[model samples]
Target: MRLLLVTLVCLVGLAPALASDLLIVTEEFPPYNYQEDGKAKGMSVEVVEAVLDEIGEEAEFVFYPWARSYLTAQNRKNTLIFSIGRIPEREDLFDWVGVIAPFNTSFYKLASNGAIEIGTLDDAKHYSVGVSVKDVIYQYLKGQNFTNLKVVGEDILNIRKLAHGRLDLIAFDEASFAHRVAQEELEPLLFRQVYRLEDLSGDLYMAFNKDSDPDLVERFRSGLRTIKENGRYDEILMRYQLMN
Candidate 1:
């Protein structure tokens, strides 16, 4: 009984360390989350940093391609990923921290293409659609049996392809599309959203690996809740002009 008690105490003491040290990872999904000047910066980054400040913690953030970040967050322990979709297929894969940003995906076509009129998701199927491989949009569309999907290594590439008329359409985040369009110095009239994927309209979330310390996850969750209630969340969003 004494040995059991000592072992229990030791395990309890180890829990905080198991969770406190985290490696935060994400892809270059701008406006929401991205790296600039070799440092993490964006709407979601500000939110995460605010939460950390509230919780009195710090962690290193690493940005990589979507697939690498996704796999690293999945295969490694004590990993947290942000601005990622909370899709059904990924439901049980991680310990979800909390929703961090708004995410709405839609099928976009060049405004110049007056010849294309998609009245339904099925109608858009006839055109070649660009999607980043392993991205939430790609996964969702592929699962929906979209046969014309043109997989790319990154969503930014999809933007360039669509701009060049290389793709008939592209699955893209609504807000990110506007941001990227402006970033590429392209006119907003160049493209328009033809179809909104209601199924993919869920907000993005921050999540720790399935095996991460639950206590640590709860701390971040609580910090997020506190910020939302205290107005810090809204302040950050307003600063970014992302309040919607």
Candidate 2:
């Protein structure tokens, strides 16, 4: 009887650890995952939490700067990064799941700046453009040898630089840019969507580390699918006003 009792205790003690473990890395980018009042709260956080709950999985998220988050995703075992742009160069680095949102990579110019007419990448070559440092967009532009491009450390500064006439153009995700503009009430910084680069349409996904357990990935995929099928996915998107 004592042996049976000991066995039961061991099983109970190990049950929690046996649950699927997920480590999430994120950055403070609004409308996605960001810190609010000292707590992590945003669309991506809520959606991921819901999915984990559905799968009966355990998850812990660490928010860092964009560069740090990206590095963490690349190096950490059993980890995932949220709302990462699905780029070809990064295709084989990690397992992908649940495309959360699609972003239009557009060029924004000052409303009064009539000299700039961006129909293609070449059209904006003469003007200095600002992009977020270490972002995929910056890498893409740099690869193309686009001259006169400036990279800022943070996304907010790109818009500010554009507003101050320090940058002739700015390349960024349209939804995120709009969210920042409205939230910050930057009405004077008139930005126009000059060129929509379909080639750079960013599809956001949850990227799991290459060394993560396959079962955990499968569970997350299943949970995501379940949420989408049951309309919880749409609800979460709507909750953040991301979906109309």
Question: Judged by TM-score, which candidate is best?
Answer: 1
**Among all windows of ten consecutive residues in candidate 2, which has the lowest summed lDDT?**
1-10
Determine the backbone clash count of candidate 2. Answer: 0
Compared with the true structure, the alpha-carbon lDDT of candidate 2 equals 0.76
TM-score of 2: 0.85
The 10-residue segment with the lowest total lDDT in model 1: 1-10
RMSD over all Cα atoms, model 2: 8.7
lDDT of 2 by residue, 8-81 (tens): 11211111222335567777678787776556667877778778788776655666667666776777668888
Tens digit per residue, CA lDDT, model 1, 1-244: 0100001112111122334367787777889887666667789988888888888877767666777778777877788888899888899999999988877889999999998888888898899999998888888888888999999987889999999999999989988888888889999898888999999996889999999888888999999999999999989888877666
Q: Which residue pairs clash within candidate 1?
A: none
Q: Candidate 1, 5: how far from true, in Å?
A: 40
Each model's Cα RMSD: 8.9, 8.7
lDDT of each: 0.82, 0.76
